[model samples]
Target: MNLSIRWKVTLATLFALACGFAMAGFLAERSLERQELAQSHRNLDVRTEMVAHELRPWLRAHAPRFTDPAFQVLVRELGAKALARITLIAPDGLVLADSAVASEHLPGVENHRTRPEVEQALAQGDGSDLRASQTTGERTLYHAILLTEQDGSPSIVLRLGLPIVTLEEELSQLRRHLVLAFGSAFLVAVGLSILLARSLTKPLSDMAAAARRLADGDAAARIQITSRDEAGLLGETLNRMADELRAKIEEVSEDRSQLLAMLTSMVEGVMVLDYRGRVLQVNPALERMFNVTRAEARGRKFSDVFGHPQLALLVSTVLSTRVGQEDEILLSPSSRCLHIEASVAGGEQENEACAVLVFHDITELRRLEKIRKDFVANVSHELRTPLTSIKGYVEALLDGGKDDPDTSAKFLDIILKQSDRLNLILEDLLQLSKIESGQVLLRREPLQIEMIVERTMAMMRPLAGKKGHRLVENIPSGLPLVNGDEERLGQVLSNLLDNAIKYTPEGGSITVAARHVAPGGSPAGGKSESLEISVADTGIGIPESDRPRVFERFYRVDKARSREMGGTGLGLAIVRHIVEGHGGQVWVEGNRPCGSRFVVRLPVQPSDQAAGHPSLVPTK
Candidate 1:
């Protein structure tokens, strides 16, 4: 049912060989029969000619005496063993003699003039015919010749005939021999056909198998045929084609792998789009930066994924002009700023062009630039205010105010106060810069939280007293010691108390309290223990909106009031940096009824023993 090419070819070849041998055998048999028949006929003609010659004289002498015994003897002698019958006919169309019969029975024979051979002899001198004999009922060949008398007149017709049985028998023997020879030749031809079919089909079979292997992804499959024929040439060509295809496939695979690696490893977000503005590829960084998954991003429009009109416009521009473009765009919800660069990918036809977009996040860079500009402006304004005051006072002293000793003393005192303010501003700026730049080193030690609070309050008590504000300390006893620089901790509390004193009305009160907290109770979750210190005040309260940014550098909710009260805005900024450097957090809250509350939480020292103090502090 599924015969291979070899068998098919063999069958086809055997069929062809058989047909050729049969045709050749048939032609050979026919030609041999024709040659045998021709030779037989020629032999019959020669024998008839000889018999006719022998009877010519006898026929003349015994023209009408066919019953003569001597004449019958001559006719019988002439026929001899060669001819089946011999006869002589007179000119009167009567039977003269017939060697096939006795002389007395010859008179009963049919007339010879109407016989085809005799009539032809009379007209053409010699003639021949093959027919069934009327006299003996045998199949025979007849030949007749005209006999002329010595007087040159038509005398008698001499006719001779031979039965064809012996000739037919000889031809039958020849036909049998030819049949055997042709059969032998046919068998030999069949064997040779099988060999030829194998020779022709083996290489093609191997080639077919090799093609299957190639289809199944076997790159090394090859035909081993060594012939110089068409099949061999086809095999060579197929092997070369396979080699080329394998090399091209491997090259493409390697290039794809490298491109994927580069896209994955890059920090910049990358995306590729087709000419129709459909997303074709998106890298991991692009997915992360845009907050999208590959499944959600691919095949979607570029504008839909980024949701930024500027980015979409850039893509459109690059696609239209086949050029590169760059712009900065800000993504919403996350508020991330990205520097996007778009370009039409090269080595593509105009109809098949694609655009590539790369996103570089620059949010932090933009923030730093804004900070630098604000810092310079704030510093210049703060310095100019103090320098202007000092300069005005010195000019007053120089403008004859020195002539009055009292006036000169007042003017000099004003210059000294402004100079002190300038010095304080400079010191605060330097300290903030050191803290922010990581230049400040801490002498970390375990210290009592209550002692740090008491010392800071004592230093600020006079200022609060001058403002007629109450300064109260609610730090519980047996509080756990915090791991911090004691001097820096004191400075933090001092700044808080001082700010409260300056901002509060004369009758309002400020409270300082401390408690021990467990991990997860505070923002520092990994610490074993922590201390929470609160500096709450009834003062001109900070707005809820400004609370989050109170610790930013030079950020002041009431800048005019801050300056009037001899305060530099760097105190809270410095406080935040110091607390965070010590692994703590500081935040502001709205005080009850009025004013602001600042809470500082620091990790407690591991070596401190627990004193079993209550974490909740009573309100004052």
Candidate 2:
């Protein structure tokens, strides 16, 4: 029941044609009917002229014989052929001869001169019209003609009266034909209109269906039409338009997908703001980076979310100028400082719609930068303290304190101690710089792990005994050989042991243990061997919060205690570097009942080398 455009147009066109044809047929039929009536009247007029000519000679010969039998015979013959009634009127307007009734029985009519047709016939020789007869009272077409002698003088008026029923009967027959033609034309017009409308509207309906599918997000929808007319042209154009739209939409979708992927993949966070400085879209990386959810980030104003006036101002400035800007924005509320670089993009999107802001989280970079600055300051401070002490002691000795035996002895001892402390600081600084700069190379060699631990422990045993703490060595007798630098490994053990002795209270125990663990995680594959070395002490353990950063350079868990014990805070950092250089990992754990444990695991040997070497402690 839904009418299509083609059907509508076709219906309209066909209806117009039908109306035009109907009007033309009606007018043509009416004109034909009028022409037929005129021809009939002309025929009747010619017949009346013949009758008048026939009787006019008779009347001229004898006026008293007006109702003669010869005239009656002539009128009867004329009326029979012409389908009319002929009346011969005298010059005085009397009905002289009649064809239908006996001439004697017909009443003699007077005032025949007053008749319009008769008067016109007398004056102008001919006249005709439909009228009622004066005596007969019958409707007729009155055709009148004047009778003239050979000299052209008017005499009697011959009036021919034709009944109107003849013309009416012909008209009725024509009307019947017209009705039948109109009925047939109406049926044809309706059928052709429906067919034409269907042909045209089908393609439009298909295109409409395709458009609906496209609106529903189906890019593959298309209309199929093959013709050369305007409708076909429309279909082809619509299909092409749909194809182009699908392509453009697909391109945009792909670009958005790629943009989303890049944003999420980036370690740096990004935020986009609209012209009103409101957060519009955010990626997961930004959410994780800012520690905010998508709901919290969206619909929030920049200043409200970031709580930074400077950042909001920067965004506004970039938007106004339609240029890219870069600056470091601090998120003080989140306890994080970020080095951000932002750019203004798409400020002129049809109505100055929106701009983009990118955030890069450089928190670790900033922290490292601070550490570098602090390292220089701390190094200067530490060196300056030792140098000032040495300078004061040397100045005292030069100012004659050397002349007094006890005073000079104490001053010289103080200078020597300060000099030793300065040497130790310089040495540690140099070692730390070399390790950090990758200038120190490990001299890999086969070395006994137990021998190095025993030597370091022996050096620390005197101090441990002075504090009345037990120092125990638990190295397994058959431990596998470790592939590492002997001096570096010795240094690692010595540092861990020294810290244990310093932090442990009197009567606390320190234990050094080494065993061969599985080598599956080691570089020396195929052979299953790893060195498990642990230094445990029954001392105050480091807090869990401070454990992760324990290996950071110049990081001290107990600053005051470390300083009092003459610790440079670089021991664990050096230990980590050395351990990792040997393909090992080092971490600290809490020992039960108030103690700390530092464990180191290393590969037995390099996988690229042979399994055995001289001077290496072999497994029993």
Candidate 3:
């Protein structure tokens, strides 16, 4: 029922050939039979003429002897050899002699003149068509010929009847042979048809099998071409296609692997989604950043992963409009706020929108930005306060305070003190700015870190005594020398000790300790000891959330408290800058139970430098 093209073509060709052969065979047989019949008809006519010619003379000779037995014997003998019937008719169209029937029995046949053979003898002398004789009731082919006497007068008409029974038998035998030959040819055609179908279909079947293999993901499958025909050409084409397909698959696989590598290696968290706004893929960074697994994120809506209404709404809007959108989302429930800048990009493929969302963590950046803004505002206010006080004092002296020596002297002293304080504040601000702007050049030298802490603590001792706080030094005398600028390192230690003393309550304790940390492996040095100086105090400690930004310029955990203490809020900022400039780091941590500790780490000078700086411990 499922007739393929090849089978249909073969069958059609076979059928056309069979039809053509059958038509040609039938036509050829019919033509030969017609020719044979025509030849037989012609022979009959010739023989009939011959008999008429020979019998005419006999009839003339035997006319006088009308009952001659010799004529009858002659008629019988002629009929036996030719397989024809001969008759003799008188001139009046009456039967006078006969060979097939008795002549005396044939009577009342005078109307033979109207017959084709009789008419031919009387008129044109020849005619033909087989018909039954009216006189004898015999089916015959009649031929008539006129008889002439010696004087050229017509004597009798000789008629002949050919039964044609032997000719019919021969034609029947020819028909039987033709039928047998045609039947044999049909059987042979059927057997050859089966062979041809198999020969053609076998190659096609092989191609089909190879195609199945290819469809099953075997790009190596190929067809073997044996003959250089169309089928072979088809096989060759399939082989070439297979090779190209394999190459394409390899290229695609390589590209996919490269894409995956880049995505995974990227520091930025990436999330790709399909048109339905569901998460389709996410890189490892995103999984770690968002704290969501791929299994939990995949097939889930963007809103669910981010858990922000604004972010979810933005994604939905972009998807509905098929346009790019961006929004910042704040990740919550932590002291350190994480600001996420989510951007949607790319478009749809296959009627499904493809998009990538890049989440940038900007928490530190936002904090730093806030510090910068606050620093500018605080510096302005601090500068203005000093300037306003100096201006007011100078104006009082210029008006009335200047007339009275006592008042003028008192105002001028106040103005001078305010001016000096203003100068100090400006100088500190300038130095802090220089350190922050990376313009300060460090004069590195070998200095005893223990002496530096002692000098700073000594300077803050009077302030600590006034507040009833104990300023203690736990610095070891054998502590290593540190590589640093003496002036800047002293300023850093002074600021930390001052803040510790100021924050300590009455009877609270402040301790400055210096020790040598063991050699730690660093890229720049295989093993090196660092000078660790810590200034600790039992005071209101810094909150954990503000620890990271405590070194930022003008950033204060308690703005009112810092201002009242004459603190410009730039000390820690300047200290951090100077420490980093010395290839060191400074950090603050909570000192166990209600206190703060500031740690400054610097590379220790070589052992040879420590003995040379023995005088570094100035009178404390």
RMSD of each: 9.0, 7.5, 8.4
Off by over 4 Å in 1: 1-267, 288-291, 303-307, 347-353, 394-407, 523-528, 607-620
- Error (Å) of candidate 3 at residue 537 is 3.5
Question: Per-residue alpha-carbon lDDT of model 3 for 1-620, expressed as tens digits?
Answer: 99875677568767976897679677866787677668768888788877876766665664444446677778777887667888776656666667776545556446465677777776765566677766567656777777667766556777778875665676677677766877787778767776787778778989999999999998878898888789999999989989998999999999999999998898778887787788888889878776889899988877777786766787677667766676666665643343344444555654343776777667777877877677678778878876888899888877777889998888878778767767767888888766666677777578777777767777888888898998778877777677678888998888898889777788999888877778773323427788788899999999999999898777889988976777777788788888878777789999998799999888877767654532322110
Give the Cα error of residue 65 in candidate 3, in Å. 25
Q: State the lDDT of candidate 2 residue by residue for 1-620, as single tens digits.
A: 88657766977887797788778778977897688778878888788767766666666776546556776777778777766788777777878776665766667445576888888877788877677776677777788887767665546677778776766677777777877877788778788877877787777788889889989988888878867888789988988998889889889999999988898788777788777777887778778866788899788877777657778788888777877888887676565766667676674443343776667777788888998898777777777877898889888889998899999999888788878877887888788778767777777676778889878888888888999999998977867677777888999999999899999989999999888777465333535567889999999889989888888877888877876787777789889888887777898999888889999888786555635553432111
**Number of the predicted model whose lDDT against the real structure is largest:** 1
Stronger candidate by lDDT (1 vs 3): 1
Backbone clash count for every predicted candidate, in the order shown: 1, 3, 0
The global C-alpha lDDT for each of the candidates, from Candidate 1 onward, is 0.82, 0.78, 0.76
RMSD of 3: 8.4
C-alpha TM-score for every candidate: 0.67, 0.66, 0.65
Rank the candidate models, highest lDDT first: 1, 2, 3
